[model samples]
Target: MKRDQARRAYWSQNLRYLAGLLLVWFAVSFGAGILLVEELDQLRVFGFKLGFWFAQQGAIYAFVVLILVYVVLMNRLDRRYSRDEEDPA
Candidate 1:
């Protein structure tokens, strides 16, 4: 019963993390790129328009970063759960 509770809590945390990362991706890809492109185009990033950059490159970069972050988080979560199992109170 305790083990099941721990597993459920871990999964809940994982879902929250996934949701936040996905929200970021959606905001960058759709919101910045399409919804606010004209306004964002007034800004520049390394010689490229901010909106155009987000549509073309920024979102992809963010997605890759999110993937790495997820992997790292999951690894830490796994290690923590394993450690808990090894040293129970």
Candidate 2:
């Protein structure tokens, strides 16, 4: 593909991935934490209250996971797209 076409393709893929990630983040944080708290609270993970834990800690953990995931994913993407700067030969 031409440079412009390659650039557009790169951005399109990035945006699609970002959208999906954000959707999952919102679902885990808002859905489990607030919207479905009552239902989630009844369920237990390691004998802990799911909803309360999600509200208090899970969201933050998920956010951190998201950040790490994004960093790793973007690094791969950059390499795939040949966007990363090369060292002087």
Residue-wise lDDT of candidate 1 within 1-89, one digit each (tens)?
Answer: 66877788788988998899889988988998899999999999899999999989988888899899989999999898777666656
- Candidate 1 regions exceeding 4 Å error are none
* Candidate 1 residue pairs in backbone clash: none
Q: With candidate 1 superimposed using the best TM-score fit, by how many Å does residue 65's alpha carbon deviate from the native? A: 0.6
RMSD of 1: 1.3
**Global lDDT of each candidate:** 0.87, 0.85
What TM-score goes with each of the models?
0.90, 0.85
lDDT of model 2, residue 3 = 63
Candidate 2 lDDT tens digits, 1-89: 35666678779989988998999899889899999999999989987799999999899999999989999998888887775233222
